[model samples]
Target: MNLKRFCTRFREMRTCYVGTQVSFLDKIFYVVDYVGAFIVHGASISDYFAYGFYKLRYNGRKEYITYRRYHIIQDKCNVLSNRCLCREKNKFNELFKNFLGRAWIDVNDVTEEQFILFCNQHPILFVKETNGYRGIGTRKIETKKQDVKQIYADLVSDKGAHYIVEEQISQIQDLAEFHPWSINTIRIVTIYDTLNDQVHIMNARLRMGNKKNSVDNFHFEGIGANINIETGIIDTVGYDTHNNTYITHPLTGKQVIGFKIPYWEDCKSFVVKVAKNIPTVRYIGWDIVIQEGGNFVLIEGNDNADHDFQQLHNCGLWKQYKSIIKYF
Candidate 1:
């Protein structure tokens, strides 16, 4: 790892170290185990705390996959996803137009006149960097209220970064009620088995914005609850990066647990079809927003899907994932 990332993880390890309630001897064992794992499996110090490896060893189970190991598996599975056609925002929208279900324009490609027309058509715009992750470099713009010409100029003038402006999605009213300011989305991770030619929905999570944020990204102070893949119902309490837990939405007091996602069966079929579209990228994390009348739109797909969020409740999925991906 680089110095910057190492320093950040070191700080996090220290925080977790201070907060853990284990005895002094157990703490020494934890550090030793972490060091050995870091050297052998390329695991980070934060991984030890995140997966509760300190406790898992005593329980005689070593099935948790670390952050580095997850990337290694992703790299092996996504050999062709490196092309960037599907990962980049503009190309992905153009490539998956049928599934996007929304209008979008690449600021780099459109002229000032064309941009003005797009703004007029879409009063509220969701602007994002072409390759941004974790909801960074994204914003909601009110084209009718702001200076359209200035907005267009600013977007086009940004050097070395491509931006795509999309029509704001009006989410289903039931899901929107939990966080009216943001479009709450479901993050469904899929694994395509090349040998069997089947798509498997590995895990799902309901991501909802908190503190009035416009995007429901877990990294941006949003809350995420584990969703039951079979029933499409949220089965766990909401969790955030700061270790805060919520049984109900902090803003609206809406119940998070047992909330059923609309069009559950359709969502499974839609993602399965989409997964088959790019067989080379076998593992993917798709962010979907359910619109009115039970139709869902594709927000984005992540080739390097995150593992920490889904495994936060002390359940390790290493063995299960290995069983499916071993043939590859």
Candidate 2:
């Protein structure tokens, strides 16, 4: 048994049950999952499960790199199969900044002063690590102060600290028009359907963040809901066992209820356009923000998006995306 290799692989295997099921291999060297899921990925799994994915193997040399999230994201969704080099979003955001136009908060070389100034002007801001996920290092800076430097220090100190500070955009004219703190984001997913060699939008989710919620990620402590793609209305919502939830605003006691996502169509179009630009990545997740005036803005792009939020809720998108397992 190659104990060292087994132990190393065990640490990286995300699913806890997977660890237990395969742990004996560590002692016996059975080489449990050498040729497992097409997309070998690390994700936010409860101790119960971790997701694995991959496209059907074809060709002689190799179709995609092993666990290369950037490479997979850069894959072509078309027959020509053109690709891009910026696997990382900070660079992707920078390279595409001039293309994204003036409305986007200019974020090339970020400075503490510029970030604070923008937050002060915009009322709310989103700070995110470019190469990170699960809302692990995200902070919604609502107010700025001279002590903003400390927050910046803490944020950028993490491993993948390369970040983009964006002005927070709300999604409603009035929450009372639907429900209190009704503003939210829609997660649109596009997958390269390998069986048919086509691209299709698998699912879209609406994530709502109230005043008390730091981030609306369905993982790492945020509230989310499944959205009906065509109607842009939330089919079901509220917190799950993993992401947590509340019946009323825990702080204000305002009720949460059925609400439509603002500017849904435009958000979908932009996601398709940018994913087309990336080309190769078969699966793409786009998080879009809606301004109070109901204008849609692209918040950021996620290459390997967590879709478990789809499954745990039994939102029923598994079959829609299963064929796209070209393992991106």
Candidate 3:
């Protein structure tokens, strides 16, 4: 890491510490989190020992010493990230555009494919919650030809549940080459690797949901499977789009494979490139859309992402994560 550049970034974020300092000690905690590099580099003997409990738990969990493990090691690692939930959508959007360039379609106000009113409108639009998690309140609505009066009324009558619909992403599907329900997405996790102070692609999973399958929220029962970074093929773990057992596809009835994710490398690269630009976010999960024909689209990004799929895949990276909580 370049000390000068890190220092510059650290100083810019320090402005966040300007207000609400009742006293010096109170201010110290606030600044430590905001400017982590300084605290880690210049920690005193007491400060270093303060982190001993966290390090022990995190490191012990990673070592696989279930034979005789201590109680406190896991607690320390769990405290590493400080669980900052304030992912500013505008900040993310700006960072996303910086890396994705024109490839990202902007959806300020409109409707997308799922919500299109008329079949005549072949291509539709879509927008999920800027901060939406788990496919909640996701709508495939047609905004253009809607009776504007009724939609406007909904704002007043409904509980201000706002949504956006843009044109549906269109891509040619190769029937012979691809399977049905092909609107699959790749989930790539990037970690700051606090111990090494380097970024690592921690995990990759495939989230598949087609028009026939509906919503891709894993909690909403969407199928999720692990894919190899070296090769796009799925790992042994597989679940239905609705979080069901590996049953047949309702529309296609094709046997689902426990391990068969396509275009794995392309999806991982798309995420890694975008992540390299967002400097503060040490951890993230990028969702990439692989159209029917096999090209990739940067659908969206997620912070504070889940690790259940990693365990399911038997990839066993949880221990690895347990090993790297010191820096954050």
Per-candidate Cα lDDT values, in order, are: 0.82, 0.51, 0.48
Q: How does candidate 3 score on lDDT?
A: 0.48
lDDT of 3 by residue, 139-180 (tens): 554546554445434533444444333345543342212234
User: What TM-score goes with each of the models?
Assistant: 0.92, 0.59, 0.58
C-alpha-based local distance difference test score of model 1:
0.82
Give the TM-score comparing model 2 with the true structure, all chains together: 0.59
Sorted by lDDT (best first), the order is 1, 2, 3
Worst 10 residues of 1 by lDDT: 53-62
**Per-residue lDDT tens digits of candidate 2, residues 89-125?**
5665665563332232434466778756665676566
Kindly report which residue stretches of model 1 are placed more than 4 angstroms away from their true locations once superposed: 1-8, 13-29, 58-61, 80-83
Name the lDDT value of residue 326 in candidate 3: 41
Better of 1 and 3 by lDDT: 1
Per-residue error (Å), model 2, residue 52: 18
lDDT of 1 at 213: 92
Please give the clash total of every predicted structure, in order: 0, 14, 30
RMSD each, Å: 2.3, 8.2, 14.9
Q: Candidate 2 — which residues are off by over 4 angstroms?
A: 1-89, 95-126, 140-144, 147-160, 174-183, 192-199, 243-258, 324-328
- Give the distance in Å from residue 240's predicted Cα in candidate 2 to where it truly belongs: 2.4
